[model samples]
Target: MTDETDVLEELASLPTLAHPTASPDGERIALYYDITGRNQLHVLDVESGSLTRWSDGEVPRAVKESPHWSADGERVYFHKDDDGDEQHDLHSITADGETEAVVTLDGQTTLFDVGDDGDTLAIGSTAAGQQNLYVHRRSTGETERITDHERAAHSGVLPPACDRVAYASNERDDSGNQDTYFVGVDGTDQRRLDVGEPGAETVPVDWGPDGRRLLLSDTSTGLNRCGVYDTTHDEVRWLGDGDSQERPVAFTPDGDRVLAVRTRAAADASVVYDLETGERRELGVPEGVSPFVRFGNPVLDDRRVLVLHTTPTRRLELLCYDLETDEYETLIEAEYGDLDPDRFRDAEFFTVESDGVAETPARAIDLSPATELDIECLLYDSGERPSPLIVNPHGGPPVQEKRSFDLYTQFLLTRGYSVLQMNYRGSAGRGRAFREELYGDWGGAEQADVARTAEHVIETRDWIDEDRIGVYGGSYGGYSAYWQLVQYPDLYDAGIAFVGVSDLADMYENTMPHFKTGLMERYLGTPDENPERYDARSPVTHAENLDAPLLIVHGVNDRRVPVSQARIMRDRLTELGYQPGEDGDFEYHELGAEGHGSSDIDQKKRTFRLLGEFLDRRLGRPVAASGRGDKQ
Candidate 1:
């Protein structure tokens, strides 16, 4: 038996919930939980508040996704990938738990929207590395390819009572410009709508119940602005102020109003938008819960919306809202019964002070330069003063570290480490220019912002131990972890790079075919177009400057950031005379059966254990007699 005393083990053992959707009748919910070693379908009885396991017998753990109910309550729909290879197939489980295959394909296939009649599905796939949209007929098993664009198209949706499909696609233009395109069911007469001003790119969200008007989100400005595109007039009517993000949750049954989630800074509120009047009203937040709302979707009962209520101190739970009364009721159906919610504390956000300095020490947070842009930093202070500091940066430079429950933050906090999550220049939610700041300049400005953030805390706060600072991240963050060690090695004692990119040139050439379509071209531009920038930004380029110990982790099947990233870094460090192991300056670990850091309970638990061990051995150890902050 495992040692139950380990907080990380406990955190790992806790089951997580995802892809939740309420049944059409509002009487039940079909969601999947990853408790059976693999994700499986589960149903909840809304009336009796009882939960039932739908996919219990499957062994060897098949990862499932897109759990939703059919037009009628008798069937639940979902898709499963084969052993983390990206090959997906859609499956349906009847109310009696009888399973049937909807569509089985050899490549990446996702079931986006299921029609009210439960006979049609909107699917987007990269079957042969040609990302395109397809409309599927359930009864006849017929598939019609819609957009034959060479580039990638995504977010396909089918509105009710219509023979047309709407999706977002980038034809040839780079810079991540995805225009909303509509095509007929038979794959003809495709036309792009004039969504907004030339700068913003619009993506299809949903259609009004009548399918006459399409709901879209213009994300060209970084923050999303909700809009309604009237098919009759071929015009766009903006809904929310683009400053605060307001995304479509679901349209009311009557279709005259859209239930939208409006978020400004950290706080979020649900609002109802009247299409005809063009007015909006904010919904009340539940008492004792943080204003950070992760609303999933409104149930069949148009009067209520499903909200994911999570805090630093508690595990996530599903909550229902009464739009009329503004009351929130918790559903006890989630599988978080055995998990202790009190182990975590809600994280606090603060603005750090960035003052001037010519220079102090080389390779350290010597300057404390000012943040050219307004950014927010989230701190999970261990509650005790003078604790170890972990500067954990998030991935997807476009993704923001919002106020939500994170097990890793809680685990680190519980183990006497203070974590600082920085929303640097490249992070989203601050608008377009802020997010695109690192566009052409990939590894430069963000590095300075991160350095300043840490230095700012060290200067302003007395509780953070300046000598015991470390950094860790995965994906782009993994790249950052290595980058920080080599660029500013004097400031960090240790670092962990998990499935991160170290070479921009290699990623452009080696990443999966779908990623090469526009994602890479959008940010880094082609290495062919900008070889100097790619060479300059790569962490591997500056590997010889390392001053601190580093831990590198990767998955063998991570096609996104291939294992070669870790291998390259390892080879360079070895060439510099660094050994690998507990005593070496560099340590490496790879999960053989995992792909791109799968959220399998065991894989995550292993990662957390490995991370805790590394940090504890390095950061938890006492300083040397002359202590220069080396991992030894």
Candidate 2:
């Protein structure tokens, strides 16, 4: 008999499998796993519970993803960087364990779709400076460019008919707007589908079974809306208009109905929608315990819809919900048992008064133990009162914080701490106007919103130790943490920035070749037009205002926000008479083999452990290294 401790240890050591793709016949599934620091593709027999690895034993240099099954289900195609240039090439491997390269390109290539005939493959390549769609004939080894554009083309789809390909391109409008278009296999009959407004971005999500209609998820109104466009008539019609987002997952095999995923007003649960009767249903393993129920572009057979569902206590398994019987059957289950479900939360939106007259609808997650609240405070207390509070500003000043299962938040909560995830004015999901609010004012108004959110938590929540408050974030979030040290010197007791950009000028000059063009214009303003904005927002210029103890973590291979950003900030802080690892000062850690974010499990674990220790040291709490592990 196995011991209880041994069982628990075995469960903890279980590995996770991700990116599941079903074969054309829906009898087999292919997935990737990082069992021991190497990614390997595995194929599982649906009926036999037998598995086989396709990648032999040697790990690919870069990550392997986007597994696409061929028409016959005998071969699987994927993209990986065999060389060190960061460009991915298309490769195909058969179920019998034979591997071969399908096509090679000069620049990065993403596998879009394999044609229904298995003779043609659609791919996106950046061979001509900008990303465009291409059709490569496996027989001739000749490539044909489909879309010619300056911006980029994304979300490419090829119908089962195999005559034409549909994709979204930002060609017509130069304002970073995208629209759906289609082209023939021979590069003839290139025409843009009328997807309503030009300012709105439309992506072709899926093709109907008959290949006569296309389902599109449009973001024209700043919210996701579904529309069906008839290819023959070139007309579009919306399914519904609500302040929510809708995604078309799959079309019924008969092409009579569409399966869609819908998010409610506050963006909590993802529900399913029926196109024919306008009926909505929530799919899950019952409802009480927050089962992780997600639709993965629904796998439709002739008889049923195969929906993927799981939870924190359930492994990724497929359930076949019959159309007639409405009964469900488990089709496939991961070899591992009991997985963590991706947490989903509703956005609590409220207007916060800023600059006296300006009121912005600020969104945030409470994470407070007490729900009964009549006052507005940044800190709160429960039975275990007076715990340390960490104000976490999300990266992508343009990206808003959403309610999802986050490992970081769970880890902090387990260590007797409360985390406040704030979605400032510049965050996405609210609308275009809110997202553009940070265009020219990076550290000015946006920074003010961050301060206001923290203040709100402190004043209304009485259980928080206000003096022990800490700030932490990465990327743009990291910039916000550093700005907090300068804009409001006494706001946080300590600040921890991970792979953050401290100098705007250095970020503009040092980012990857592809990101430099937009980074210079979006956050730091144009180098020629607004040099003052660049100088003003640079955190290095205001480094002297940093009085709190600080810790900086960066990955040497980080191309988004390069390592130099952290090195420059550390040097300046040292110049200001601060010593490394000294008490009440600053510390730096440069992860050797990591990128913008630490992907290595050991590195992530160590980083979080160090972060918790630093926070405990500053907040006067007990420092314990043991806690909940990685979420993924």
Candidate 3:
């Protein structure tokens, strides 16, 4: 206990690594790390323990993100935006750490896809609020705007043999309708490949390692179906669809089969799909695993794939799955840094009475009014005789709470607080219909499920106190916290909303163009068609119902749910006589040099410590004094 660091300290000191890209030769792995308080590109000698910084300290404040290695292993490409400005430009750093601009256009240009030969780069060229695909060549130092799509256009992969790039665009109709398109590498032969149905999204996954096919995942049939686009016939063939969502992990080197991840209910399974007979063979997942595929990446050799596996008894570990013998080997250590894996608890996935899945280390309780549908709820043990409980509502309506490591949940769990995560209606991995439950009724059905989840946790858990229950979430989850606290005040003790939406109407009108059109317009319909519906679901309309302590934190540069929402929320709270600060029920913070969420470690540490302090004081429970395990 004396040797263990607090949750805030751990979260602050630990480095977050992402976007791991390997060189074409598979000798080096380029990863973006936030170890220096900001994201920086670092190259790892995969065979050795040597780590080298790929970029010099020229762009200190610029978040060095999206590190992709050149096929020749000579250069690394990345994008950087200064001072949180959206004016991103593409830059390439050589093997010797010398960086130079690659594509400097009028508007922001981001490197989307780089070809195998390392000469051609697919760039998302944005100007005057519209983005289009551009092909940039290093050999000729020439750039060509390919699609000329008036709407947003994003590309994925370019086959080594074919002179065409796979992309998705909504050029004609911008009702958030996105479908796959292929255009020539030199701005010719533009053609639409798939006529996906409305509300269907077809995204280009990646180019085949053998250059024989292009992998794609289509949601036209309502479930993400993994398929391949044959370069020989230029025809698309589907492997599987419906029921569980199938995501293509990687294609075999010979192009004879593909590794696909199938999510069935709350659990995940790895399968190998045959390209010839279309036969699928289910592979063995890790032993004692709760069956959530945390990490899976195909090694360049196609002999073994790296996967992150978690079990109810252990934390996550990178395992190498060999395709030939079907054996697994530990690739990375089970422990992170010097942190002990035994001290952590893995979430247990459960099916509620209404078929909803809830995940937590806590005991799950079923809550359903006599007339209402039952909802799943997790109850974590606080270890104390009586303890404070925090209800966690996840973002993404269709994102399920699975058996995996949740950093925030772990942080709160170690602080002697029980956290409840709800897998409400519309959460994915179940099926098409189950995930589509909140299509036009986002605030209606999901809110009921969240309320039921919280109520069940407090009413059934013996250690949880009803008056100390709180809700916290970010983005979509942020909306859940704000909406739940405002509409059903008596049900929650306090609320902390991070980059959340307070008013659906305001969100629909003020969000960024693509998000406003893509997500909100499709999720809740346009305000022009459903003004009353938007108002009915808005938490601001029922401001009089808010009586709990509320804290709102938002990044000022957030374009998804603008900072204005937080300002408006604070205005409403002040108008309702809730003062700001230590004694008040309302508090707000707007962080600069940040986006919706951030990769800045200092800011994250500051925000997390503030959260702990607020919860400890509000719930009347100081977490620093608690060291006992709260596993249920």
Candidate 4:
């Protein structure tokens, strides 16, 4: 039998590699690696296949964003914050391990694009209160504000000429709707593109080789579509058939075709479309693995491109694909230590009837316009008959739960528990109507979908222990755990909410300006405009209904969801006569020196161990031999 230390070490010690970017010459790749517990910069040589750590020493902070290579490939630029506060400051490191702070700004700062000549950097920052675009000159050491918008705006892409930039902003109309705009580096000749409709999302993806044509992705027609906007003609040409969801990823090396990813049933495939002939050809990528095209230019050459591939059981691995040979070479493999890769479990896909379509929708506040709702879910079995189950609802009420790998899910499986993940309404990968169903309904239909799906899986699968079911998640998922336990008190035996939102109105007030305007207003309107809806949807309003054992974990420095969210829930539970201690059912764990999530390996291991201990004590751990299947 494996001890707790061995299980935690094996499950939580897997190293990760992310944000792979090819150098300008396409000879080297820069990526962020967490092999030293926290993320750091690493350079991978394409020809030699040797990886070298560029950042020196171990620091408390890790690289927060993708590293950008200089035009000459001598210096790589990245950003880091103070213990995940998200107030990123730009830094540049040379090949010899010399590092210097390039641009230091207040609030959150993002390095959007670096000029081809290595003279300018287009960035978006919240230093002036709201996110705005700016241009930093390398030679003169000067930074100029390019836009003075009242709302948040992000720099999208800077053309090769380095004279202007394309950005996305919601300053024109509703905060929920975003449109693309072009502005000169000197803050002149600013105009919006007539590419997207009102109340639709449009953003620039990449620039063509000629610098006159800009690639765009929009949701004007209720599904993602790629288009090319010509600055000279002031016209747009759409690509692909208007049936399935597709988004432009990058322009091909020669600019003769557009490389895009098409989504179907929550899985993605890479396809290239000929600009002149309108012909589409799908790349022969491996089946069941999602290819992640890095932002900006990912096309290394005419015959080769770089993509990060992932699956349900494996972590992200960088790959170099050859278009001519239809073969891929793994550049960086995810380190799994001495454990067998086959020990991890794969997901089984299932489609459950939406709770709204059922005879009686449980806890649904109002009926949405969606008539037929088919909720997609992934179930990871622990190989034990009658296993304890964890129902994990993903965050980003708008984000979809793809067949991707998750360390937390794998950790749960290692502890003799099955995992059920649902892509509830408002999840992406589905069409517009499905995502819009949860727009104004927050904890209503989506919560109902989760409950119904969990109930359905419990009823159909004899291997799942209905009495040992738990609901857990982080971010919006954390909110779902709170909402699920309160709304459907009898459904869950235990619950864990990590950095979750308990009060909707409070979250709107305390969150960043971009989150408030871009997400909250778009989802449920403003607190003043719809105060009752905010109160009605919040979990704190119904905290009295919570009867299950609940564990609340949050980071003190979390700016996204805020640690106050957990504090309020703990206070409420206390007011309702519940105590928090080793002898108590309600518990709260606050992590210091961390933000929305932790990057330190020790913290991750501690949290995993705590969760396992909590659940084991609450819902007795399954015996290795007969298992919980014999209970029923």
Q: What Cα-based lDDT does every candidate model obtain?
A: 0.73, 0.64, 0.68, 0.82
Question: What residue pairs clash in candidate 1, if any at all?
Answer: 312-345, 312-346, 313-344
Candidates' RMSD to native? 3.7, 6.6, 5.1, 2.3
Report the number of the highest-TM-score candidate: 4
Q: How many backbone clashes can be found in candidate 4?
A: 0
- Candidate 1 local accuracy as lDDT? 0.73
Q: Pull out the clashing pairs in model 3.
A: 295-308, 398-428
Q: lDDT by residue for model 4 over 33-93, one digit each (tens)? A: 8787666788889989998888865323434567788888998888877777788888889
Worst 10 residues of 2 by lDDT: 364-373
lDDT of 3 by residue, 1-632 (tens): 23224546765556665556666676666766656656677776656746677765544343434566666889887776655555577777876878888878775676777787778888787654667888888898988887776557875467875488888877544354678888888778888775456656777877787676788877777777887887678788888645567877667667777777777544566778878888887767654422322221245456665555665435555455677898876544443556665656555444345322222111112222322333444444546556778888888765776655666677777677777886787776654555666677767656767776776666666667666788898888998888787656667778889988888888877776556655776678888989988887777766767777788898887766888888888888889877898677777888887767765667767677767767765666633345432321
Local accuracy of candidate 1 as per-residue lDDT tens digits, 547-592: 7778999988777778888898889888878888988888999888
Best model per lDDT: 4
Which run of 10 residues does model 4 get worst, by summed lDDT? Answer: 357-366
Weakest ten-residue segment in model 1 by summed lDDT:
287-296
lDDT of 4 at 390: 92
As for lDDT, the candidate ahead, 1 or 4, is 4
lDDT of 3 at 477: 91
lDDT of 2 by residue, 420-529 (tens): 77666667655555555566666766666677677777777687767678888998999988877766776778888988878887887777534554345654555567
Query: What lDDT does candidate 3 reach at residue 413?
Result: 71
